[model samples]
Target chain A: MDEIPPVLLRILRFLLERRMLFQLLEPYEWWLRRKYPNPPLPQFSYQVTIHTIRNLYGRRGKIAWASLFFPSEFFHAARLIPFYPEIAIGLVAALRFVQTPLAAAEKAWFSQDLCSYHRGGIGMSLLRLFPRPDFLFATSSICHGTVGFFEVLREIWNVPLFLVDVPKQWTRDAEGYVAEQLTAIARHLEREWRVHFVWDKPFFFSNRTREILLEVEALRQRKDRMLLPPTKNLDYLPYYYEFLGEETSLRFAERLKEELSKPSKTLPHRLIWLHLKPFYSGELPALLEKLGLGVVYEEFTTPFPEELSPSSPLKSLARKILWASEILATSRGRIPGILEALKRYDAEGVIQFTQWGCRQSQGMVMLLREKLLEAGYPVLFLDGDHLDRRHSAPEQLRTRLEAFLEMLEGRGSS
Target chain B: MCTLGYFCRYVPQELLEACGFKAVFFKPDFSSPQCSSLPVPFCALCKTFISWALNHREFSGFVVPLACDASRRTYEILRALSVPAFSLDVPALAGETAVERLTENLDDLARELLAQSGRSFLEFTASLKQALEETLRQQEAFFREWGKRRRAPDRIPLLFSGSHFAHVLLPLLEEKGFLVFPDLPENRILLGEEPLSLTASPLEDLARFTLHRLPCPRLSGPARRTALKRLCGTLGLRGVVIVFSKFCDFQLYEIGLLGRSLGLPVLCLEHDTTPSFPQWETRLDAFREMILHG
Candidate 1:
């Protein structure tokens, strides 16, 4: 649980304004290492996570609302601390730490063909890495993994678990259902946590929502005259998942909004990321930006605020889920809304990120690229894993992005 | 000369019925353990269709669209068992090219079916079309009747569990005096059909829908419990019939959860295109008895 990298430690020390405390703790780290030679570490990463979370919240008196993306905003809005186990489990799977435990769980359950993420998450939960969440909320927005994963947690932990139901596609009725479920969950939380869950929390939820939406809208803005600094790709996930509900998240979003409002730095060719995690190498976005090519929008980032409607809270949630659903629905189908956004954002090319062994994504890549081509958008289908660099075709992706950017520039010049 | 029974989906049921063979469309019970053994990952309706077809000998054949991977696999498994299966490959799109390809596939299939069953394609096609047209008309009429039945005194109104099942099964169930309250299909279809303003990637959509739609027993705990509570509250439904296709893993995973949550008598059924009228009749009778007595 205490495997903090020195650099990250320094960063955290800086961020938390604990520089003097960090120096005081530095000598204790050496003394502790000598006192306990080879401290017994938890075999599973989730166990380590559980220990870390228990340490954090126990001291601070914060309750975690473990959730997926669909219920994330609502949970955040309700003022509950949100934890995304998928991001953690995904990182573990990519790192290949919990394979044996995952395999054992899969074999034990006789679910050999279940998604690796499900098996891994279950393995982590079984190992008690998640520490029993105060409340577990899952969205039926995507896949059976979270549903069963949370059920196992409920049975094991005997805690309150809620399923935020989202419809298969986005529609008004689905929005109504989602809104009702969110409201129900809100009531349940209020009863259990002894805290009022208000939707009209001025600067807390609604302000954050407005900020997220504005950030998204800014990301959608074109840099035809090179007015804005290109948004970093690596910052997207951490900004959303890690910083969500934190005051820093709102501040960072504000920083981005401010940066976008500034005059041109360098006009970069704009591109859109289709799927897969873009921040894996940490070099792609920087490289693209260096090469005067900016990633104007990412599929995951845009769906959050773009789906929200100020008039209807539940409808907004449902729309967000539906918007999220279309991104993963099928390969060949055209998301007119997303396409229109790409055009509006002045994205010259689209990068379809394909993770290996992700059957759902792999199955639809060819079809999706074909559709994008038909729509006259220069598309680059890049096959790689965000964590598993061994499977990454970085050189190929770079080549494709570069070539596509060149072609766009050529078209513009002609 | 040989009669056949087909369940849901619009394929060979009409043709088989028109060929002077008795065609009975039966929906299966989806809660039973016997129904869960089939190989599909989601949707118990397919399994019920298959289990009935395999158990009963009266029905001579089955026809289905290979619209999905599981159904296609089910068709193969059933075909190998000498079920005299006919599979029509329907494209994802409903364009002219898809229609042409489908017509050709169906024509070839219709010929082979005609020869094996001692029926001509011309006669079978005309009759089958008529039966299908009749079924469509009957389906429409049933909806109207269901609307009237909703207002009746003895109407056992049951809320269909989810959008996936409610889309196809709700109307059929409603026609039989069960009114589906809190419509799930109308909700799903309404959302699904609306144009997106900002959509996620296509893969993301698939993942989301698969997560939501695929009836995994393990994942649907919350949904099953919600459905059970709703059923208990709205209609005080005497019994719940969980319908799914054979080889659907998601729904099979859910049976225990649903059963435990509801405590109401649950009848689970699995089906493929194979006919199983006798077995289904027996099960339906048993279910009816349980509802009346238990």
Candidate 2:
């Protein structure tokens, strides 16, 4: 399990007031930049974190709590700082501070079987750990849990919740429906935040971010070696989802490409990662290294070349959400995409990490395994909860991963 | 007529009937061998339905709604397995466009089912018109009887709501001397208080009626609380009993707020594939005492 710094833990535990916490984050931000100055990519992430924190609690502007699927582009255009409570709770879990919040959530009748991230979020909300939101926004594109999770938060905070319903299929009518909702949200934000809403700013940043991420993706495909750690790509998930329309994200993407362009050692075995890895610990990364397997591509950071148009911003964003992997994962739509990524990256095996409570991804596992095997690739399925360390079984995971790696090596040799 | 099984209440049974199919609500059963095939974390109710669908291949088809993640994926699994299934996309947000979207989806489904039955458009329309009229009449009669039951004295009137299982509890509640007014999505089919009309566009009316019905937990807004509050007033409900399957996301998230919002003594029960009937009996016994004595 990942260990939290003793000092940081003590500080977090004792910091009862949001104002005091906000004040302490200033030094914490400085300490982070000072500690991680060599690798600018991690520094960029830290900077975004500090910026998000300041925007959320610093009272600099309006803040809208949203699901990750709610494209940050809209918030950027409306000048509202977007705060993803799920992602925030995920960070708390990674920091190993989720236990208290999770317990509090359960006390409030949040079941143990629901998504842990959501449970942690609710716990934090009940404990008043999060800032009050001007509003809550969510998209029904990823998982139904998001909608319910945000609805509960809306009740807790007594805020207006805006929902953008993205259909499973990408028809013109569906796109129009989503675009209309997006437009309504935009108008609502403009009136509430006292700012004129325009898509030009968000469109420019999204287009640039997309281009850079595509380059980063190309670098991954072209490089025969895995330069970074096994779970390094998973770190870019937040950037891809939450900062996709921000300058900081564009800088991070460019820096990531530059970092990946550097030459590194090639591993004996290469695998493609499906879904998310256990983010609460470094054990999986350690195991992958020990087993001499390098992850060439992670599905969450799989970059698409679609361009955002300023002319019809809502429609384009709506189309993007409709075609997102989470929505398409229900059908056989993601299978072709995964197969293409596998061939492009030239990975030898697939590892599907099934996060607990994620029925959308778990439901697709059997079909994914069948299709990948039929295409002459082996698959190893690993089950773990991303946000809860209680579910982590290091011994079992190590044994399964070791056996899968050995089998892959045997297949390659034979 | 062939049978078309469904689990969600949003699916228009009238349309299915018009297409020469009997709309059967698939109740949760625990004995299917295929239950083990689903992911372990899936809610018990969805697992039961998927297991049953996998084993019972004799049904003409099944209609799966886009109400929840489990149900949506159930549709995906059934389709992948080559089981005859139809996915009905229900919008999560409510609005004028949302109603129109459901109407369009209903139209698409009507067309597909009509083609499957090898019936002409005019014949399907005529049947749909007639089915709508009959449905409104039947639902009206159900409400009238429910009203009379509500006025009956010396009985504990309890509102039963949650994820669509534990219908087994309706009779059990009655056995326990509780007047149960079921407010579940499946029960809403016959309990819809909205008066639907048969017009040139009967599909539109059906869509409006379904959307306007007591809002399910999956639907966005506080409309669910509002509708339930009105129902509580209308029925003079004394308490609530929410029965949901294990790991049901919608119910788990909504039940707490619902209980608190209702401002009444509430008992929330969790059902698994193998529910502990004795434990429920003990809890119900205690709940009965509290309601009757207090």
Candidate 3:
């Protein structure tokens, strides 16, 4: 319910009129690619990067804003560009302009307690910075924040919303029901957008998406000895990226494996970070390197999931979605997956980054910490906003992480 | 008898009743805060529920239905507490398959109850059949007896849409000479006659009746405007009241859509289900006065 921030709106009007949003983004994206070069990796990320820019500044209309949890495949099938304001919020945070949106949302009566993603998204929407969607869509979660985020969009945009609600418990019945809903939503979006969706079903292993993902998965199995660097766009890369089910991400994964074929000699402490990490600090991974802690794998990012085969495309995707380690409501399915990741990565410690305003993770922070700590693993339940650095006190985080790392150092050395 | 505590209306009460467990909705005194609760900038209802569960060992077990993130997390918290929690995976989208999903959830709950109660499948079936018959009977009687008796104050009554029952809201409204219908879908379990197919198995019939028939704000395409009009007309309703837990995106959409579509005076109150600020009272009083004296 945030009113358009005058300052933001004025700036956006200028940017929109001049079509300089992505043009302005050029320097930043260019810098990031340069700062994190490992050879042959930049092309894939570069390919995926263009679409994010194009969706906002590319053209007018035929764009759909979606929740992060909504799979990118359906949108791809519909030939509709998926614009996630949540990611936009992240971009703002990465740009260190998050406070403006936060202030706008709070001033407009959005409670400070609401997810920062919602606040940032609403604030951006209020500024008319987000692209106008022909329609809005979301994959529903037990978290009302997801639905609430879109509801704000629907109210502001007055566009038709297509919502696909998922179940907390993963059963064949739930999977089938969700598949049916996804199919319905896909068809609805196609009809509404006046575009027919055709699922890319190649005769066999098209584009080697399966081959690359499986190889990535195999690399993850022996991460202890592998020189795996924390992925550049870690969280969004595996699932949210446009490069998924295509060669862009495949080449990126291939390059990553080639680079990480040999183990790091100096870095001793290996850690697995849970949930998505905020990109507010560009030097976060470098900071981790300084701490002698390298993130070997992310819970959501690793096990590079296989290609979305068109066989029972909806149901198969639904099955993958239902059993998805990260998407499930609570610690039920996620815990086992995380535990598996911890052992597979041979993690010395685990950092459960409890993003600000995300209730799904907040709901399970204590339990996740409890189980991990109880299992003789050093666990740090770090509370920070994913997109808003204002909520994350860097000094406090550093201190806690230092302590956790110290503890892990002792446990590892002894 | 086992006392099974629940928070969301989506969890089947009659299903639990069939399993021979005493099901009770957990309503905390919204005016007072439990000091031991986990203070987060999120749903106060889930925080309060989790806060309460953190200490008390009153219920033998808990059934946390999948409604929103808070409740789902509350389930995780209950499990962490080792409180024999059952998290029901209710669907947000209602359809034939949604009915099947809910049926599976209901059956899972039954299985959990059986494991705890040592009841046979046959016993559960009989209890379910009896419960189904009784639910149908209640639905019939509820509609038949609607507006037949004007035993109370002649103030305009409002149809409410909310997942959690804020018990204190009713008393506060009643003190202001207003009537609030706690149930939104005409019946508590959505056992409305419109969506029921009277399937072969009594359990399947009940699942269809509970989920498929319900027009929860979470679900898409419920013919909600028509349904709201019919229910309101039948009850001689004057306005709609949307009460949701704070930060519940699910209810906010319903609050906005239903408010616009109904073309009636709508009052939205977002409570944390804890005893905190009593700011909602003034709004309710104003809404009540508008429907009556205006």
Give the winner by DockQ.
2
Tens digit of per-residue lDDT, candidate 3, span A1-414: 223467766976677756555566666666666865654555545545664665457554478777766666666666677677776677667677777777866655565667787888877776676667777877774355777677667776878887777776666666777788888877765676577766773212223655655565565556455443453436344333444544445566667667556654436677777877876776556666668777766765643255556766778667666656244455867777778777876777787677777777776776777777788888888787777766768778778778877888788679
lDDT for position A21 in model 2 = 58
Interface RMSD of 2: 1.5
Task: Report RMSD for candidate 2.
Answer: 3.1
Score candidate 2 by DockQ: 0.69
Per residue, candidate 3 scores C-alpha lDDT tens digits across B32-130 of: 454243535556767666666655577778888867777777777777777778877776655676677677777877888888888788988888887
Interface CA RMSD of each prediction in angstroms: 10.1, 1.5, 3.5
Per-prediction TM-score: 0.50, 0.93, 0.80
Where in model 2 is the C-alpha error above 4 Å? A1-39, A325-328, B184-198
Give fnat, all candidates: 0.04, 0.69, 0.47
lDDT of 1 by residue, A1-414 (tens): 223344654564354443234344445545655665534322222233443343333423344545456545565566555666656665554444545445545444414344444555555565554434677777645443445556755755667777664444355645665676666667776787775644444225434745665654764474533322344533345346544544545655655555456555655567776664633345665666767766667665553544344455555666666556555542212356557767788677777665443334443444455557888887776666554444557678778767877888887798
Give the Cα error of residue B98 in candidate 3, in Å.
Answer: 1.8
Tell me the lDDT of model 2 at B135.
Answer: 74
Instruction: Place model 2 in a CAPRI quality band.
Output: medium
RMSD (Å) of each candidate, 1 decimal: 16.9, 3.1, 5.3
Pick the winner on lDDT between candidates 2 and 3: 2
lDDT of 1 at B243: 59
TM-scores (chain A) of the candidates: 0.68, 0.91, 0.85
DockQ scores of the candidates: 0.05, 0.69, 0.37
